[model samples]
Target: MTHSERTSAQSTVDIAALPSVPKVLLHDHLDGGLRPATVLELAGECGYTALPAGTADGLATWFREAADSGSLERYLETFEHTVAVMQTPAGLERVARECAVDLADDGVVYAEVRFAPEQHLDRGLTLDEVVEHVLAGLRSGESQAQASGRRIRVGLLLTAMRHAARSREIAELAVRFRDRGVVGFDIAGAEAGNPPSRHLDAFEYMRDANAHFTIHAGEAFGLPSIHEAIAFCGTDRLGHGVRITDDIDLGPGGEARLGRLANYVRDKRIPLELCPSSNVQTGAVDALENHPFDLLARLRFRVTVNTDNRLMSDTSMSREMARLVETFGYGWPDLERFTINAMKSAFLPFDQRLAIIDDVIKPGYAVVMG
Candidate 1:
């Protein structure tokens, strides 16, 4: 059979069948995935009286709508409430623990959930204390998932807000916790005016220390932002590097010719943490059909799927993969490739990463797809 015929003959998967597919999530937000009910409870616990919605369902709807506002800055305004509620240790631990539990419930076996250590400083928790609380909560969540016969291991990514001046400090915290649950460091926030190169000192410091780091780039901004992140800041991975789509040259019959930048990324296998639903919500693309995900994947650009903000996008790994499978006619082989890509690009040690790919993800998908 011809390649196209073979591809067309692959079975389509139902969305409900995706939850047991053994997903590996590389880019997700801790504050962005808080349960709506938990958000209400935390607001009450912390005396945050300015929530726009008092009811659980209403608040959830409010978050989804606000993130879909088509303005990047406005989309970010929703985080104020989540970060506000996460000031205290109890609040941090609760959210962190729940984040892990929810991902495990969605059949995510390995994940690296990130949040800004600088953003949770409203109530005066030291940076060290903040990291400790998140790590403790993740440990608690891991134990809970294991007890439920669902195996999950979570790692923390300490993020420094790019618009702020704490990247160096956050980098230090990440390196300090390298042997702990902390797996990597990152810088996230608006990408238009604040370039990742602004945190060069932090990136260079991580390089010197041999630490892993990913930079949030090309989500709202364009190719320049991505160029600086890769050429200047030297991130090991890109968080939402979807705008690299602008660099591809599609000539005749949809034959893609890689531009210099695209060639560099594809040649180096720089992992683009492509978060499709979030990209659409934030106006990164016009719609799901217009997304560069299929093109990037076709070109073998080391693309991996992610839910940038689960609550904000109202997405899970299952939902994200289902959307792609339905749109692209991706069957088990495609889903398995994305899962293995994420696992390979994970920030864990080489041995641990390989172990999961072999012992857990491979076996899990084999059973599900069989």
Candidate 2:
């Protein structure tokens, strides 16, 4: 089917079929994707007694409810439990392996999973050791997926906590592992009070080393964070940039005008990693229907869908896409465009990105469209 033909014929999509379509995820957190069962098992192995629930189902419910508190700072507090259990190397490996397998099973063809190395140092493991184990698990999961007739390409994005002082160190670690599995660097945490400019040294270091990095901006804070990230830090992408809508003026007659910053963002083709469910959970948007995803898409911004924290939001790539379909009436062609946007905006080399867009993404979507 041609693009227009598919769009008209498949105006409505079956949410169940979303899992079989190819998807690309650019903004997923490693610590936030852990399985409830694995969290229980790891807590036990690590002798951590801080988990709120005894069983997997109960823990899952706890995480979902706790994260729904509607404050980004409170939402982040749930990570203390997950990070506590992941202090050991074995714990990190198991989480990373399962994360890869889960994403692959959900039909994600390419994913860049990120985690902060500084959060796992309580067990005496160095930064290098932390990254080594996670990489090993991802490789194992890739082989396992291939054996099961699934194809997935996983890359690591080493994240530094925005409130911490080890961003430069983490940036160095990301560069050191660039050839192994690390594709980029990031700074994540509460965006309030801890501005992206605080880590200028790390961003500069990445630039000097000719590395790629994205900043967690415009989620909790607003346009100032995004402006600093793009204009100052030179982030290749904006993580959860839903608030960029603030710079747009929507007229009563349905005309839209973009401010200087918003125009620059659209003009530069800067990708916005918009997470629907997570955005609602953290109170970034009033509700999913109120999300600016459709407005931004209609305005031709480089907006890509993502699952910021799967466990907290109880989301997968498939679920995120389905929510957009339900809320914005997106069809197969729209989903394909979002997937293509993510693949093109990936931190991988140009040739590799092009190869995946041609060989994996286009073919996979073609099958679904037919």
Candidate 3:
């Protein structure tokens, strides 16, 4: 059979019916995926009176609608509520623990979740306390998942708010916890005016300390922000680097040519942590059909799928993969490739990364696609 015929045939397989596909998610948010019930309970526990709705499902719907408003500022308002309820150690631990269980049930074998430690300090906890709480929560969740027969291992990425100058301290915290649960560092929030280069000292310090870092770029922002993140700040991976599409041209009959940045990313296999629904909600793309995910995947760029904020975006790894299959007619190979991309780009040690890919990811996908 011809290559196109094989591709078409592979696209028709039933993904949901497949038995146990392993996944690696490198860009989930700890604060964003709090269970709706947990949110309500935390709000009550902390004595915070603001909520968009009453029921758990209704609260989730409120978050999705608020984030879907197509305005960056509006998209961010949902986080205000999620973060508000995450101030205390109890609330933070509960959310983080549940997040692991949920992701594991959704087929994620490994995950690196991030949240700004500074934002969790509203009730006067220090930065170290904030990190400790999250790490403790993750450890608790890991033990629970293991007990339930799910092989899930989670790592923490301490995100420093870009609008704030605490990146240096956050980087230090990440490096300090490198042997523990903290695997990497990140800078998030307001990417337009808050370039990653603004935290040059932090990135430089991380580099010197042999730490890994990713930057949230080209989501609500554009290519210039991505350029600065890679060229200036030296990001190991790019969060929502969908705007790199602006640097490519799809010529006639689906033949594509890459501009310099695109070429650099593709050639070097710089991982693009592309979250489709979040990109659409934030107006990074006009529609899912127009997303650069298919093109980037076709060109063999290191494109990994992620749910940037599960509650705010109301998405999962399965949902995102299903959307891509429906839109771009992706096959099992594409899904397997994306999973491998995330594994390779994970902040785990090189040997651990290989073990996941070789032992877990490969065997799991084979069973699903067999």
**Cα-based lDDT for every prediction:** 0.91, 0.94, 0.88
Candidate 1 displacement at residue 7 in angstroms:
8.2
* Model 1: lDDT to the true structure: 0.91
Off by over 4 Å in 3: 1-11
The stretch of ten residues in a row with the least summed lDDT in candidate 3 is 10-19
Best by lDDT: 2
TM-score of 2: 0.98
Error of 3 at 28 (Å): 0.6
lDDT measured at residue 86 in model 1 versus the true structure, 0 to 100:
98
TM-score of each: 0.97, 0.98, 0.96
Task: State which candidate, 2 or 3, has the greater TM-score.
Answer: 2
**Candidate with better lDDT, 1 vs 3:** 1
Writing each residue's lDDT as its tens digit, candidate 1 over 1-370 gives: 7777655544557578788778999999999999999999999999999999999999999999999988889889999989889999999999999998999999999999999988888898999999999999999998898899788999999999989998999999999999998999999988888989899999999999999999999899999998998999888999999999889989889998878998999899899999999999989988998899999999998999999899999999999998998788788788889989999999988999999999988887677555
**Cα RMSD (Å) per model?**
2.0, 1.4, 2.0
| Decoy 3 TM-score against native | 0.96
What is the C-alpha lDDT profile of model 2 across 151-241, one tens digit per residue? 8999999999999899999999999999999999999999989999999999999999999999999999999999999999999999999
